[model samples]
Target: VCVFAVKVGFQGKEFAESFEVGLALAVGMTPQLLPAITSVVLAAGAKVMSRHQVIVKQLLAIENLGSMTVLCSDKTGTLTEGIIQLHDTLGIEGSPSERVQELAFYNAFFQTGFANPIDRAIRDSREFPTSDIEKLDEIPYDFIRKRLSVRIRRNGDSLLITKGALAHVLECCSTVETADGSLADLGPYREAIDSRFIELSNAGLRVLGLAIRNVDTPHLHKEDETGMTLVGFLVFADPPKADARETIEQLRDLGVGLKVITGDNRAVAESISKRVGIMSPVIVTGTDLRQLSDEALFQRAREADIFAEVEPNQKEQIILALKKGGQIVGYLGDGINDASALHAADVGISVSSAVDVAREAAQVVLLKQDLGILVQGVREGRKTLANTLKYVFFAIAANFGYMFSLAVASVFMPFEPLLAHQILLVNLLADFPAMSLATDSVDPEQIHRPRRWDVGYVVRFMMSFGFASSIFDFMTFGAIYYIFGGDKPELFQTGWFVESTLAGLMILMVIRTQRPFLLSKPGALFLFAVLSITLITIWIPYSPFSEKLGFVTPPPMLMVIALGVTFLYGVGMEIVKALFYRYLAHR
Candidate 1:
């Protein structure tokens, strides 16, 4: 409202000017809202002031987030829905019927102490016949016993229903009947049922044993919950994410190994890993990790793709071990349990809806909570790091030429290679575009490839290429000085003009990683524009302005030579760079 009022008051003013005034008044009148507005305004400031806060608290957080190399995460709510569902049932005994299944489902539905995935599955199974099914005494689920039992009244008769781990249920049952109405001794079937249970468990499926017993009279409660006939086992699981398998394959293509660090049972973790394209035949559990020394642990981590029953502390230990082996680890997590490990990784990335501490501790936050985002983030980070190194490479190279030309001219000639203004202009003009492009380059192929930092390689290339280019500029400047007249003041003017032109070309060469002859591109065009403007200023005539800066018009032949030498120098530098890059590639 205030902005509108101010804009209406200054209707005749230019749009931009009115906007500026209106903005000022609007902010000035609302002092209480200043802090919030100030945050928004300063949020877009340089990294050092905003995201890259220098305070110790923020610095430590950012460092931890950026340094994540391995991620340990919880399975429930992190990878799966934390909700289990029974999608199908296979009956092995006694004429499989929906009536029998509904009875088992009803018993499971009403007996619950916790809102676990298994319980939810029973409740979601569809409405049962409550009129015929009367509640009775119940034995709730126990982690150790791994079973539950209930007594109920149905159709004027009392019955007992029991469900539990298949192996435990089979141990107490003496006989089993098939759905085809055939009976078999429980002794021979025990091994077969146990083997099937192991198979299902290894695939991360939850298994449940079902059984029922009939009584002569209806009863609300009963004892002797044991010695019931075993019906069959039911398997349940939370389905895998649709893209998990494909994402794992993509990570493998980029040379990033996929490891499942989960607090689930070993069988469960192994199952999920196999389903998601992890081919590792072995799994390492927290118990196994606890028994190994640090060296053994690292060796194991290098080989294993699934770590199960991993506690929070063990997550950090695994990450540290991976880092010690010189691997750059990226930790992806979403729970508070992951915070410690997240803090210990090379790149800590969190899903958008992750716990507060996890998100705050992460360097990168994925707006979408998907594994694919982590893949994308890694690619972008690598490109950013590469471009930054390139900037450092070229900046040092250009500086080498500048330093060499100045040093050689001071010793062997009457004048320096460049004046103060010329040096300042070249530094500003050359650096801006180079830095901009360095920060902005996007390479599509980079995401599909893995890269490791090699400090030695960077230093070697920088020194060799930078020194060679500097020497060339030095020799070229010396030749110009000698040809014009070594000690004459007139030659000083020619030297300055020639050296400045050479410096511009040297900068142009540094900017182009490929061919330098192509100056029609936007980057090269901007470079030339700035160079021309600076050179024109040096020649501009004025009693106060030009004279004070030692301006002097040059001979027409000097201008031609300056332009010609610059073109030739650019061509030579490009050839040198190409050869150098080729040699490095082959090596």
Candidate 2:
């Protein structure tokens, strides 16, 4: 109103004429409740997502979560229980032996960085007399080396003990120690050892190689890592959680793709991935990734599901490559190694038990490691998006129709179709029903796939429904001016106001879903609000407030004709909706 007054003063237009024209123009514009409606809807969705054990740290991430096309998740803790137990120890000949277990126990017992589950498994298995064993030095684990080494003294002789990924350890060994305590050249048995590793990994055993070397010096250097005797293989088993396969299937059904990224061997990762039903069969290793350029990596990243033996930096690179392939990537991890990848992803997701670095980098966190909870969050996000778009489409359509009616009517009549104050009253009364749209139920079919805002789709939907609504408004104008003799301003405003309110409320029922209105019932609050607002709007002009609001009661015959026009408008919109969705499906 203030802006219009300023325009009138600046343009030197007459106050009476400008004020009346401004009111007519304002009434034709879209409703002013969009920001408030969006806030209410998003807050309600946040509350629903909270109940599913998913915490949304960034509220805007909720929308991105819905649009996520690829989920790159770590397998150990996120997909499994992360509880590893020492299952067996194998000699260099692939035979189970007690001597290998004893060597593994000492290697795990003496040294420490942070506590590891694999170390805990071995330490808790049996008590070793460490009083006779003295620690000399240690090399902590590194992702590139994939191993940790410790030098210790037993019986006044210094020996260096190393354990890590089986293949990595094999490259460092020159000889093998058999169960009989004899050393043989590791060259002849290298092929057999690799075959044995594959067999064990395929069986889902997390396999590691242990090696030791007798050194005269008290210290061990990185150069000393070579010329070591490969002692044996330590086998650990971490079972997948019971619900993992079901979770994978559920996500697949929702049009979300899953990929596994881990530092484990390709055989082990592949065996586990197949069991959990991951789709892409190609595996890319960190070494294989390094040899490829960024363009090559991007092409492979699209078809590869298992990224094995990936370093933290490689993990970040893989995420970037996937994004380049045009996917909205979501990374889930709990270890400090995952922080870089988490930050690189479009939406970083973590669990409640994740390390501080990982948690801080994540935008969304699952309070539990349950994939079911994440699925629920996705559904809720799509629901919020679907309903928000519904309101926009309905508003644009109904407003366009009301505006078109006023533009056409003004050319034939000298008076304003509606007063400025009456237009505001009608807008206020109509919006009371829209507040309930946020909490309304969304159809399962609408949420079966990922949903995102498409400007082209919105424009098409608005024009198709908006123009159909205009046809009905023109029909109502004909009834008021020709049939009921309501050519005067007071009678025309009252008649058109009642008809416009009914049309907006009735059109909401059609646009809120793709299905017919009878099959998709709205929530009780929405239904009650729409019904109550409709009744009150129809009864307003007959009330004592009618004269003060510049309205007059229409005749009984005119009321009957308004109902007929509204009914036909609804039927016409239903037909347009069917054709519009059909057009959308083909597109």
Each prediction's TM-score against the native?
Answer: 0.64, 0.91
Instruction: For model 2, state the Cα shift of residue 84 in Å.
Output: 1.9
Mark the 10 consecutive residues where model 2 has the least summed lDDT.
2-11
Top of the candidates by lDDT? 2
Off by over 4 Å in 1: 1-194, 202-235, 280-282, 443-448, 451-453, 488-548, 583-587
Evaluate all candidate structures by whole-model CA lDDT and list the values in order: 0.58, 0.83
Which residue ranges in model 2 land beyond 4 Å of their true spot?
1-13, 16-32, 97-99, 102-115, 214-221, 278-280, 404-413
Q: What's the lDDT of the predicted structure labeled candidate 1?
A: 0.58
Per-residue CA lDDT of candidate 1, range 436-542, in tens? 44334334543345555566665666666667666766666665666666655544554454555455545544444433435323344435554665555445422
Q: Residue 166 deviation, candidate 1, in Å?
A: 9.9
Q: Ten residues in a row with the worst lDDT in model 1?
A: 51-60
